[model samples]
Every structure is written in structure tokens, then in C-alpha cells.
Target: MRDADTPRQEPTDDRSHPAALTPQQRADLIRAAAAEVRERVQAWRDNPNWRNTPANSHRYETTLGAIGVLSELPEPQTEEALASLADAVRPIVVEWRPSRPGPEQSIYAAVERLWRTIDVHT
Candidate 1:
């Protein structure tokens, strides 16, 4: 048995939970997420270390696509989809590092973190 102080893990059933959001709500969530993403992207762009790295640019593009998909998803399904999308993008981010010559760090990880944070609040 778990201790009382332990946090409860919410049950997740995609069918029931994901299907609960209305279309408008989903769109709103997407917009909010996109705004956050844009801010992060701008930060990345402003970073001198990130400017010259081609890998970072590619990662940024991939994140943009993911954000688009997130925006298009049905409201109810957004949570599950975002979680899955974050997972999918994590590896790409991890493989990218600024130190590597050809394949430096990508924005994937940062994006994933952003998605996860959004998922929690929404």
C-alpha cells in the first residue's frame, strides 16, 4: 500500500478522458501551448550558442510541426496526444548536443518539457 503523503496518480483512459474536451477548448489549449512554444523558440533564436547550430534549427522545425499537430487535435484527446508526442520527440532532442559537430542538441527535449508542463495544467 502507498503512504498517505504519496501523490495520487490520475487514471488515464484515452477513450474517456481524451474524448471529453470540446473542440473550442482544444483550440484554446493549442493556442496557449503555441504561444509558450514561440517564446521558447525566440529564446533559442537569441542564444548565440544556438544560432550557428544547424541541428538546433532542425529541432525547432520538428517542434513547430508537433505544435501544429497539437493544435489540430480534438480537445479531449489533446492530453494523451501531447504526452505521446512529447515522448516521440524526446529522443530527437536527446541526440542533439551543441558540442557535437554534425548532430548537436535539438530543441526536442525543451519542447517535450514544455508539452509535459502544459499537459499537467490543462
Candidate 2:
């Protein structure tokens, strides 16, 4: 147990810190989320009902925006880049609701995963 006289010690490994992520980890996460979004987009593209609702259209646009941002992330990604991606997708993350329940949920969940990774590590 630490006592009042004892000094607080810092983590020796940066990865053990609350907000530290390796470059590979960040890039892998971005790639994974982008792939998931792509799959959802494909599924929705096959379903005319997915686009009938106005709310669904907005959500679809944001997911496409997420894909664009994710695609634009440069190699050897930085915290700033991940944070910017998070910022760009924040509205959709907060506002997500599928017109139907299948593919859109997957897209929302994929973006949520990206948000969690960035929020925790960036």
C-alpha cells in the first residue's frame, strides 16, 4: 500500500498508460473499422428500403464520410489523425439509428469501435 510519504510512480511502459497506442495498433483499428463500414455500405446498397427514410440517408452519408476520412489517413498514423477522424465522425456516432436493423447497426458499431480506440488511446 502507498503511504502519504511515498512518491507516486509513473508507468515504465508507455503502452501501459491510459492513453497510449502503438502506430500499428492505430492503423490496424482504422483499417478494421473501414472494412466493416465498407461491408455495411455494400449491404445497404442492395436494399432500396435502407435509403427510403430521410434519417437513413443522413446516416448513410455520414458513414460514407467516415469511409472517406478513414481512407485518407496516411500511413504510420498519428494521434492527431485518429483524433481528427474521431472528431469528423462524432456526430454520426452520437446520432446513429438505422432505418432498418441489420447492416446499419453494423456500421454504427464499427464506427463506435473506432471511437472507443481513439477515445482510449489518443
TM-score, model 2 to reference: 0.62
lDDT, model 2? 0.62
Q: Stretches of candidate 2 above 4 Å error?
A: 1-20, 97-100
- Model 2 residue 5 CA deviation (Å) reads 50
How accurate locally, in lDDT, is each candidate? 0.50, 0.62
Q: Which pairs clash in model 2?
A: none
Tens digits of per-residue lDDT for model 2 on 7-113? 77633433443355566666666567666666766687677665566876666676677667766866556666656655655555666654446776666666666
